[model samples]
Target: MQPWTDRTTPRPALAALLTDVVPANRRTLILGPHAPQLIESVLAHSSDVTILVRSVSDAQQLGEDFGPCLQVIAGALDGLQTPPYDVIIASDGLDRLLGYDSADLSWTARLDAVAALATPDAVVVLGLENEFSLLNLLDSRPPHERHGDDEWRPLHDDPTRPVSVDQFRTALPWQAEVYADFASRTYVRADVASAARPGELPTRLATAAVDQTDVPLLSPAHEGLDTAARAGLLASVPTGWLAIIGAQPTHDIYTESAHTVLTATQTPTGWHLTTTPATTSDTSDTASDTTGAAGELLVFDPGVVPSTISSGVSVESVLFRLAAAEDVPGFRKLAADLGDWVTDSRVVLRWDDVVYDGESFSHGVSGWVAQETVAKEDLLAAAWARFHGRLIGQHRRHPWPPWMVGDDLVSAWLGMSGVEAPEPTPATSPDTLPVASEQVAKGKQIAQTLDDLLGITNELADLRTVLAEAEAAKHELFEMKGHVYGLERTLGFRNKAMKTRENRIRELRGQLQKMTAAHDRIRDSRTYAVSRVIFHAAQVRKPKVVARKLVRKFRKR
Candidate 1:
């Protein structure tokens, strides 16, 4: 029973046992580092399966692969409700790796809590490796020669020097014991296999069929198979089989063409199909049909991707890029397949630091290609740098930039810009300061200036009226002065008339003395009296009326 080589073979056995013995319509809770694979297999057998992951990120990945069909819970088992699953299987990821004694119930209590969540009579399954048993299978290396036993150590710490299963087990003592104890019943046993050679079985377990082969989960340099052979094996895995491949030494595994091919295509059920002959140009409908509509989910280790972390670059980064490259046609097919599944689907892609999406003008890809290839750039890095610079500049300008923009105001600002602003709340709001009010104030000032101008115009109009009145008064004064001069001339004429009357009186006196005529003297007296009366009337008369009357009187005189 070379379990590692025949990873898919156990599924049929497990499926048969489940469908034949266990009742249908049962809900299963799968807990493991690689629980997705088991869940995928179980889903094929049963639809009512709920997967619980330890981390939020894991849940997201599961959702992406399963298309929201799977319900994921993030809390640990200790906090979960009872009877949550009909059958529960905790895969390679258990607290066992954390160095607790195998006999302790702490790890078991966690499992019990998980099992309690299952339906009554539900069987609890745990996937684990026997460390002590496996250590016996190493290439007879001394105990001191083995690497450290820290569970967090990189999978590829000794890539060039592949450690045998027994050596690895010896290095990690508590890990194997924990695995052995957690299972209600064990199906895949690592005891004999870990102690045996790659192709051989242990004499003690050889007679019994419960055996396994020593195959490196990752690339092993000393292993007979090279990278290409391993890749071929990975690609050729049977349908309904999902593989979670991680890189050694924290290197990326999705980069190489082999990894790319694996990530690009998905297995539907079995690996029996012979390799098709390469065509100069694949024009067939099936060949061109790139839809990965039906296949197992392939999850690549994102930690190996340098773009995801701030750590140094590793070979694993290459793996992700390669997978992305090979997935062009496959992913497009998947998108089409999912068309009927979702009312709306959005894919946001960021390469260096530049972000793009399916909604963008270019449909996520910024640069163009040869109509077949996708150009990959280190855009995520660039975008991150630019974003940091902008943030720093903003911080320098504002001590509390976030606080400056209240939650509601930020939303309003975003709304003004025609973007979907979040609701105005503490959690959803941004903390930028308000400046639009200042603009409004400036506008008010402009209006006030206009009003002042209007008032000035009214004052100018009033001054114009006053100037006209002053000019009229000046003209009336000039007319009054001319009247005074006319009156002075009339006075002079009256004085001359009086002098003439005196002379006439003198002449009358002379005539009276010379002629001694009573009749002439009486006539002169009458004339003098009449002339005096006429002069007095002329002096009392109005200007025009008096002048006209004086002319008539003079004519009579």
Candidate 2:
């Protein structure tokens, strides 16, 4: 029995790749769970095909759906006893090929087993999911896929398996074409090599891929993908890699967009570029289809022979880099050039879609045209307006003040672009010219904003904590000052009391000195002696009376 009944994941890029690699009437083997549309596409290419799915129920549905045209095996890879196939399609990878009764096999072991069932000269298109894909790294959800061992047994830490593109190339000594398969798009090496030589079609497709996704990504995928592209790691960091063994690659780069599976070609045909569609049935239209409605998207400009190469890095990407780096002067110069490019004719263009080499602006590979006539000044304002929203909304730092709102910055940018600035709009709606509404409100952009806000909230909480501490210290200081004032008053009162007591003691000492001087003068005088003698005679006549009188006199004194 299988772990899950239906484990099919739809990959349009992989499917588009299949249509190119899988030709007509070739014995092909699809040896894992894949989208039904992909399987049908393979079957349509070749009637002699074998599909091995682990789920019995899925196999039953497939058998009922396709009838006897396909050989559907509802069993493990080890159990299947079929001859080697010419073309083996395992774009779904081999991890899902595990079952209850199957032995614990490493990634390389399974690949070896699958390789054993392929002929020496067979074309094997195998997929390897990148654990380090930007989307995978930016996901904020729980990693149940890593821990869900009960359902699918993942081979962990297999040194024999390739973890990166270089390692994969090293592992496969044969000629193999590797594609960086994001779900919506895939880039070929030639297209990704050099924008000046081939073109920046890969980056253009990457930007489209970023815009089309509606998932809850942690940050803007465009920024990450752009940065990856600049760092020369875009192909190395896709959702997965498709290694086509024993055959050459098909095109420069192709994207399975919402509209069609478009392919870009860079042939020097009188300097006009052209791009073709992968398959007539799968693609809605070719990239070079110029017959689009007046206001609708165009596949590509039919004039450029190599739609993949461009003048230089996109004007839009450079402008964003300038803004992000806080390079206002550089941004203003570039903006002026962009403004010059957007006369009345090119007013509906987006900067991200255009590349500015060093000097001038080129009508880039953006597929849209202005629905109605737009003013030159209004287009400049619209461009700056979009930048303003993304700048502040994404919490990106700028040379301008944080208090400055969108209208302020937008007006400033317009002035820098040498255009007549408009009246300031106070409200901060996330809308920009092309994607203005999504500047603040888009799920991916808002998720980045949310992640930044969470960090800001923590910072604000820390500030509040410091303020609380300061308030407590302020209370302590106030109490200390009051205590000091009370001590000063008490000391003043004690000093005043001590001065009064000192004055009283000095007066008593002065009186004691004068009395002693008077007594001394009386003793020195003769009259004093006569009076003393008379008192002595009276005391002698009545000694007891005299003594009593003397005692009374002493008591009175």
Candidate 3:
């Protein structure tokens, strides 16, 4: 039989949880029959791993394919009689076991069964589809179908049956680390935590490391937002949820690409969350001293007050100051707060980096600090303009407000920079005013000329449309003419065949006439008359005379 799951790659969320939360050496128990990639990932890390499938055939097939390294059990969760495992992964199959008919009892029994299979401190990873994703609101089809998985069969037909984040927590009755799966339910992109909390800031950046193949699950309209912002939005209305139960709290989270590292380190003074640069090294050039040099770090200040660290300050001092904060929880929260502040303040920072040409260069950092208060309307106008510009870049025909061009756009830009639009000055002298009026009249004449030109262009476009239609009709007529010509050729061939047949009939009639003449000649011959006269004389003779003639004839024979 074919594989039960269509997935070739392990779900991103599941992979993240496995790499970050579950220990490599732990004896793992995979409760559900998952994708092959997921099974391989679990088996690679854990020596004592068992997969619980629904049927004995599935177990036997998996065992034959994976060999004896993996133990496959064929039974229900409650029926399985095995030792408690250190980690239990239930990425799929749990939802089906927990039937949609009775959600409460199903969840309760499912959780109990799961708890029984796991050790007291085992890490339980549960994945569930979130019905309230933004894409669901925009589209009528199921999320799986929209993602190109048309054959995916859901346990419940009703969209409302799927558990929400709140419902999931209530059912589990545990403090679980919740993560939002973007692009699809299988890929976890960001952790869902209070945006107000500083500890969750790394998750925002961690989203940047998500595989680029996973794209705008919500819609193309959201493509304008950066990865971090998009991740936050996904966390708000996630496509799916990955709940890591009985897992330890994490202080730092690195993006999958490992380009950015967000660390929450505790100093002697206070707890500080810092986002720093993570560098990759090339060891091919051993002679070069700067071969493994790290990239420059840009630490955003989370405090309300602008950073005092100047460009003249030493890089070490700046790093030290960034490492010492009063009450930040995580890198993600700090980043989010800073982002929000930047949006509100309309303070933009532009940076340029200079790479060293030789091994003599050392790692250095530069800093910029600014604070500004902009009006709400001005900020809104500025944001709208920027967003509109981005939309124009993304789409071929972006919808723009009719009145928001020329002077309006300029005014918005000025207002966004916290500057008022200058008013027009009045003309003071009467002589200058008359000249200005004459200039206005000329401008009106020019506008009229432009209007006439526009009308002529429209008429030309219409004529082009008509000419294109006429050309199409002419081509069609030529095709029809070709078809008629072919038909005439076929008729000619048929006429030739009929003529040949008529000649054949005439030749046969001539042969028949010759045969009739030969038959008449054979009937009129003198030998046929002599044979008829002899037969008539024998029939008229008496029986006695005929008997005597027959005796004489017999004697002669």
Report the number of the highest-TM-score candidate.
2
Residue 469's lDDT within candidate 2 is 61
Tens-place lDDT digits, model 2, residues 178-280? 8776654555552253232212557666655644444445555656776777777777667777788887656656665433455655565211233443343
Ranking by TM-score: 2, 3, 1
Where does candidate 1 have its weakest 10-residue lDDT segment? 254-263
Give me the overall lDDT of model 3: 0.46
Model 3: lowest-lDDT 10 consecutive positions: 350-359
| Candidate 1 lDDT, 464-518, residue by residue in tens | 2345557878898899889988988898898899899999999999988777676
- TM-score, per-candidate, Cα-based: 0.26, 0.65, 0.42
Q: Which stretches of candidate 3 lie over 4 Å from their true place?
A: 1-8, 35-37, 54-65, 74-79, 96-105, 142-152, 155-162, 184-192, 196-236, 249-389, 393-557
Please report how far candidate 1 places residue 513 from its true position, in Å: 99
> What count of clashes does model 3 give?
9
TM-score (C-alpha, index-matched) for candidate 3: 0.42
Ranking according to lDDT, highest score first: 2, 3, 1
Among residues 3 or more apart in sequence or in different chains, the pairs in candidate 3 whose N, CA or C atoms overlap within 3 Å are 13-188, 198-330, 199-329, 199-330, 200-332, 201-331, 201-332, 201-333, 202-332
> How far off is residue 437 in model 1, in Å?
94
